[model samples]
Target: MVFDDKNADQAQSLREKMSGVRNGLKVITLASGKGGVGKSSITVNLAIALAQLGIRVLVMDADFGLANIDVMLGVQTKHNLTHFLRGERRLDEIVHIGYDGVRFISGGSGMMELLRMNEGQLSKVMHGLTKLDMPIDYILCDAGAGINDNLISMILASSETIIVTTTEPTAILDAYALIKTIVKRDNLHPLHVIMNRAESKKEADHVLDGFSEVLAKHLQKEVNRLGHITLDPEVPRSIKRQTPIMISAPNTSFARDIRSIARELLELPPQKEPGNVFSRLFSGLRK
Candidate 1:
């Protein structure tokens, strides 16, 4: 599994894209229209895969009400994101480094705490988060399902959003609904889809086709397919073992799929400026 020169060059380009941004953070928020679609599973392993490729990754368990990255990763830390949010500790102090060298912050069943954050507290928490000194290459926010204010804010602030869904009709319809809501409400960031628990390649293609059809016909938005993860027993086995499938069953079908997805993600071209030279020059001068 050697990364050739081309792959290395693309990874470097991606790093450069993050270099100009403050905090060196490329935030990727993972959301779902509904649960039971393996959203958290994808988020955890994706972060692990990136880290395995020598990228500094952080999984912010932003699921808020139902955060479970810690359990999935077998982390039994005392502190959580709420503790940092409440100013009880620093972000680094609460982050639990996993076996794969990925760092994660637990969401901590802090239902009331998250719901009660006043504007001032929220501002302080955001400020604290910005102050984290690690050269974080990516901050993967695993957001809970549904359309909520917090979820919307996460999507808006993220550099990219990965919407997870399955081939089921209900899941596809709900995913389209979520995409429609994001376009209507935020309408600024790019969104990608990941078809999870897909029974077959054809089913995954069908899911992506349906999503694209709906978004194009109704919302007039062009959504990108980030690829799909097949349904594999290793996923549940790893879950029971409290370890990531990428580590526990790296050769399994789903693990191979995830690795392919990770490689594809690494090969993605950097976001290009959407203008000619003169426009870019003017925009740069304005900045």
Candidate 2:
């Protein structure tokens, strides 16, 4: 097939622009009102699924108190976020590569100490992150459940916040409560939802509807429904194997759903400017 010169030039220009802007590194923070809703599972598989589409993804396990993305992904720990926090290593040194080309930064055990860092340390960490060499397409922060200050900081910094919840009434209530807090605290609008462990589409819809209604009526905000993962046994089995469902059981329905969600997220228009020379230069100077 003959290539069109005009199209080729346009493609090249787009690539140049993307390279200049750092290629749209979107930061998506996943949080839950309560634990046990498979937040880490979703985060891991979603990263893998996105990477399957040739998108470079980094899953940052931000659940400081009880971090386990490393264990779930079966990545043996040589070093973790603690090393970076303690200035023993740089952020890039701690990244662990996993299935389907996903890279992860393990949230070291007892990282609650890092949370106590004075403003200077926190600023240093943030500055360090911007200087990393990897051109990450997405930085998925799997934050701890609840509305603590750390979690709030993560939510505010992220380009988008995904709230995972199950069909239980308590889960729904907590999800609403968390969104309400975010709205009031940040003065932000709707928060995204990922309904997990639903038995059917109807069940997922019910869960989404309940949250949407509350947000609309009570908070005067809209809750965007990203999608849902069904009650698939393959999920837990894959977790037990310490592998992502997208890699361990790609043919399973749960894997299919994960892939679908990844596609949806990828297809969404790029939100943040990927990279800029000024930002990179300043980042380098700060180091």
Candidate 3:
């Protein structure tokens, strides 16, 4: 397989930067096989839930083409990731604090540029990320849907990848494709699956069971079922109000499920304690 030298250099520099950071901030990249799978909402609520547990969390709206985490949280952004990428603003300056103590950085129109960055540009971006001074326990990356070079790169860079999907057959197929692509590339990082908009617990279990069986039988990859979110009327109401269900309707089924998922993630073995994130990511990328 042919490799791009610039991409390689960029990866190496990112790995070095990650290894140099001493803090154990868990970087979680939430991705999906297709759009309209509720990936961003899960990311927003999960970050808020984690923050409620007293864990400092930051969300990066890396969806690029269709970024909306800021809008969802009702926090208007004066500046976004574009400003930081252009060296016009620092990461702290662009990070917008939102409801429930969760912070976010908007992707704006600069997401495509982020994906297509060459080695030098990518290195600068990585350096800026490492320079962030927040005492963060988690950094949730809301990556764009599907398998793209940018999506795959960010997935590999993160300490964990959370794959979100609904019970839809197409969505499941796409999720499988996404997992297959990642495992074929590198399977060192842990993968977590979440079923959103599930009608019932039994249905969610059945869907994930079939999905898991396919991976184990064909791809030889294992994924942890984080949990599922039931379809709730309050979810849409909360979204329309620009509030998270965890904050708006805390007692609702959707909110409770998200909180449960947050606890599960916290209970998982932390990747940051093992080594520098960059070292671990680089090792996976180079494989």
Candidate 4:
């Protein structure tokens, strides 16, 4: 909420001096209450879009159950978060390059493994992250779908969370449930939404009207609707080709929607990234 220390400003300035790093390492998680809503796909392309804008970005596949981000990007990973947890690799070693110069880490398939991590290991991991030669501007975490202790903690610790959902009745209901749970825990949490796989802007807005109404009346929270992504034939094809839309089909409507979202995100006021990330993460479980 305030300057962490006197050197906070100086440290931030130094990070900006890096090749193309943005001012702060803004942490964002793109999540959905149900899978198959295209959450990971949006995360992958969104990170690349930000990178294309000259921002040093790192997208983490925080699912902890699936490692599809790499598969979608058509890249293989020699190391992941599991290796770091087992003391087999450093944090930086787990990061791999993706399209448009974006960086990424694949979260291994064991969410609970993090709780067993000790303070010493946590310190080492933190050092590994903060000491990167080229600092990161944003850490976009593709948090796994569904509600759980780990997911809630991740959403709480992030600077902002974009809930990706479709216009399907079930998808909308699940998204509302997710929002209710999050607001129940922290009503003041900053929330946003991305309408994906929509038929048109009219349909997306029709859904938002009822959705945001429920939040304002019952939960007392208003969410920002970033924009909607039209159902483009190019999306599935791009996925099959293992190329991000931003690179393969930049002229498609899908890529245009992503670029618009990236611009909207960049305009947000930067949040202060505190030191000792793991401490803040595990501490949430204690509450």
The order by descending TM-score is: 3, 1, 2, 4
Q: Between which residue pairs do clashes occur in model 3?
A: none
List, residue by residue over 33-115, the lDDT tens digit for candidate 2. 88788789999999987887788888888887478998888777789877887889888999888886788888777666755
Q: Residue 267 in candidate 4 has what lDDT?
A: 77
Candidate 3 colliding pairs, count: 0
Superposed on all Cα atoms, the candidates' RMSDs to the truth, in angstroms, are 14.9, 16.6, 11.5, 14.4
Instruction: Please write out the lDDT profile of model 3 over residues 60-156, one tens digit for every residue.
Output: 8888746888888877788987787788998889988887778888888546676565556545654566568877778898888767765666676
The CA lDDT at 217 in model 2 is 90
What's the count of clashing pairs in each model shown?
A: 0, 5, 0, 0
Query: For candidate 1, lDDT tens digit of each residue in 181-219?
Result: 677654656888889999988989986887798788998
Error of 3 at 87 (Å): 1.5
Residue 73, candidate 1: Cα error in Å is: 0.7
- Which residue pairs overlap in candidate 1's backbone? none
List model 4 lDDT by residue over 23-120, tens digit each: 46576878898888989889999999889878889888877756578878877777887788787887778888877789988876445675444434
Better of 2 and 3 by TM-score: 3
- Give per-model TM-scores: 0.82, 0.81, 0.86, 0.79
lDDT of 4: 0.75
lDDT per model, in order? 0.75, 0.74, 0.80, 0.75
Q: lDDT of candidate 3?
A: 0.80
**C-alpha lDDT (0 to 100) for residue 157 of candidate 1:** 53
Residue 177 lDDT in model 4?
Answer: 85
Off by over 4 Å in 2: 1-23, 110-123, 268-287
